[model samples]
Target: MEDPRTDGAGSARREPEAAAWGERVARFVRGRVFPRESVLDGGGPEAAEALAALRAEARAEGLWALPLPAALGGGGLSFGAYAELAEAEGASDHGPAALGSAPLLDVTMLARFGRPEVREAYLKRLVAGEVRTCYAMTEPGVPGTDPFRTATRAERHPDGGWLVTGRKWFTSGAAGADLVTVMARTSGAAGDREGLSLLLVPTGSAGFRVVRELPVLGAPGQYEIALDGVRVPADHLLGEPGEALAIAGERLQLGRTLRCLRWLGQAQRAFDLMCERAATHDGSRGPLADQQLVQAHVFDALLALRTTRPLVREAVALIASGRDARTEVGLAKVAAARMLQQVADSAIQIHGAAGLGPDTPLPALFRTGRAARILDGPDELHITAVARRVLRTYGRAG
Candidate 1:
């Protein structure tokens, strides 16, 4: 007898092609790539080499640069398709970067504002994994949520060049990056947000220095960057002065979407692990899968996952359809990030003491989930924006 779930009646509910690709990626990672539990935590030159090899293999497999446009050697996936890939990669701790699947928040900015030559030179290399770049905007003393407080400065030199001077922190991927995309104040515009410009500075250029590879929570990778007179040709400037804020705004919107996609991936993995553990444990006399409380927690996590999936998908679709989803993207980011934290915490609860041990993946998953709330932007900030938008639309006083 034909199964009802496989018949034409259920064809409309078939899994997405993205899911199939995601499953392939997951299988490859679990079956072939990830080292055994003995060698998962530390970062070293050897780990870096292994990661690079994996990246090269992923690139070779026609899975490289999934977020990039088709003309640039990417899969030419729409936002929805790319989001699914991100979710898949996010399922494991190093899977995203190892697969060359880090969020390309500025891809839209590059497509819209970059010069033809700039796109050809930089974006093409980015797609090919020949170069890695990190964004430098946040400063040591400046409030991250306040963009107007940026202290980086760029002055036009007499010889048609620009000299940039600044210090930035929490610059992820900068340690191994070939280029740094810097935002600097280029003019004496009245407001803090005005007169900003984006510049591409090569790694070995004079006056550009990586001060240190920061150790965050004992994990190494993020870098502190110092631009003590970094000089670049006029052509290195990404867009006109005074347009940096707009570029950053657009990039953040897309970044939030990517964050949501990545978080969804991590949450999915955590939920799966929790369920597996629950089904097999015999210490409680009854399987955890049969516990009412455990079931409730699992159901809640699944509900959040189910809800946020569509929001993320919709945001991706809207972006691909040529609609700017700034506000919607923020909401999605906040929702997914908060939900991920809840899901991870619940998984830890379901796993009991095993969740706290380094041997289990839950601890690492929890750390990553915690970082998501602070990455891109804090959830409080997004909640504030969401509230303001709602008030303006529905408030009687308005």
Candidate 2:
């Protein structure tokens, strides 16, 4: 049977040419990136040189920017098709960046809300991998994941610009991003959701600074940044003033769904490694796969993977159909995050001491699995939100 994950598009849907494209992506990453991740992660000149070569290879294969719109020079794959491709691309940590598809979210957002000049300046370069960007919404004093408590402020300048002042943290990719989209309070009082606005700040601006590259759960690249009286041109404002939430909502809906797809891929990769170990490794009594205890672990891991796959697909299907999938996404987010963590634990236990070492991918996968629940809104927040949203159906006030 065709794997339902790739085939779930139904008979009426387009042929999942992605099954072939995805295989190509997987092969490229496994051959080019999977073996060189350590050098890339080391942040050395050799890593940069290797990455440039790998990216060039991806571009040569016409694999660059597969996630954006074809009109924007992307492959124009549907969310479903991209989901298949993303799963394969995600098996390696550097796959998206190496393949020139890392800017999908930023490009999509800029295309929707940027002014003509802003679009002209950054859109094409972003699709072509000439630049990179990050979104900064989390602030130090605010309640994490609660944008209503945002303290960053952007005051309009008299000469067609704005003065942005604030400190932000957990801004992913900020260390290397050329432009940063910052969510700040531009109108209304603190805690007023409607007053928030997003502004584009060039990293080289006068008062913009990257304070430090945050070491999140032993992972780098996340950063803390400060913007003190940073002046940005008026045209850089995204969407309308006092309406950042709506634009942010659109980005998050798709962003969260894509993260779920990638998480599924990472989990599947770990599961494969775990099974490979079980089948081949010698144990106290023989092959680990021959042991009943190890059999239980394999059964449980497969069960979790199969169960979460459909819930995530349901959310992806709803979002692809342009429907509000808050509940579906929330459920999938929690399930996929926990599933990855659980499966990683099982994989580690099966690998014994080898799991925690650098020789295996389990340690890295485990770290990401642990961070997943917290990064895209913590599991607690999603659980409460999903419960509240679901309870509202029976006329119950959550």
Candidate 3:
């Protein structure tokens, strides 16, 4: 097979095959697995047998971990290609989450800075779906947009380990996570970006505890974690102290790009649902599709999907091409979130009261829709970053 990483842009490559495989994977999940999404409706263990069977099948069919490094037992798709595949997976809630295929910031840390043993221990398990991990950076009372304001403290331990103490909320998937990639201040560094480090803490470790699951407006569950003297060996530290911000910033850009792709899938799904509802509903004299208001909403949803998809695709391509697209990714993140919100809202409006009820899928989609504005750093933060980049790149009359 041709190496996707080495192929030149716009050159004839194996992307078609990769996209075909992604479609197959998406179809398999949609046909066989989505019906079981009800398992995750309430706080409950996913249908273990079905889930395990799907994982095994995915692994056998070379569709396991698309985002991890290929040498580490993952599909060797590039970021651009992976973004396309991610859109398909993101169309349904269970697909991306269950596959453990979303963009993982900690994976970048482990790949770039971890020791060989650390990679073998953590990355392998994560890629194989044997464990789930969460990145804990945001504190409960602190504004998550400003990392310099974090209050979590990690003190050196006498036994060659570290003691981590803090409270974290809005942690995605932390409830069932096997480990947490925690960010804490280790030194008395003057700047927020300094004196910080990333540590790996096991879930049931000495002082690691989950306080409660937070209920999002539309999603199933998130978790609040309290680390009261959680201890881990010194080897748990990822990268050197005071390098957390740089590492996290780089990782966050990649995360935002991935999120844009996922939300594209979500927006497309909503658009499709809206169209289907419009075509079939007969509350008006004509089909909803025949109504000018309904047509206008559908047109707006299509435009949003079209506009955001290319921006996200371009951002992913730029990042994959070894360019730093912190600004572009930020702008794309904001646009994608807004577009998805608009699409979801239109879907609900087209469906009328039925959309709000449990019988239709729009309510569930609305829950996911509402979080687009906040997840992976909110719109305000990204907008600020975009402005800063704009000023630095094109300052007044320089």
Score candidate 1 by lDDT. Answer: 0.74
Writing each residue's lDDT as its tens digit, candidate 3 over 1-398 gives: 22323333332334567768678767866775567666656555455665676677777766777655565555656666777678878777767655657434566668777766677788867766777888888888787887887788899999888999998888888987888888899987524556877888888898888898888884655889999998988887888877888778777878878778878887888898899999988873877788999999989999988888888887887887878787789889999999988998999999888888876667777777678889888889889878987889876794
Which 10 consecutive residues of model 2 have the lowest summed lDDT?
A: 1-10
lDDT of 3 at 50: 59
Query: What is the descending lDDT order?
Result: 2, 3, 1
Candidate 1 per-residue lDDT over residues 110-139, each given as its tens digit: 667777777777776776667778898888
* Residue 86 accuracy (lDDT) in model 1: 71
The sequence of per-residue lDDT tens digits that candidate 2 reaches over residues 1-398 is 11121223232233457688888898998889888889887775887788899999998997877666665666666666778788778877788889987787788788778888998999888888888899999988777778988889999899989999999999988877899999999988788767999999999899999998888778777899999999999999999898788988888877888888888888998999999999999897999999999999899999999999999999988877777899999999999999999899999999999998999889988888899999778999999999988878878468
Q: Cα deviation in Å at residue 209, candidate 1?
A: 1.6
Output the worst ten-in-a-row residue range by lDDT, candidate 3.
Answer: 1-10
lDDT score for residue 251 of model 3: 76
Candidate 3: segments with Cα more than 4 A from true spot:
1-16, 46-50, 189-192
Q: In terms of lDDT, which candidate is strongest?
A: 2
Arrange candidates, best TM-score first. 2, 3, 1
Clashing pairs in 2: none
The CA lDDT at 52 in model 2 is 91
Q: Tell me the spans in candidate 2 whose CA falls farther than 4 Å from its real position.
A: 1-16, 396-398
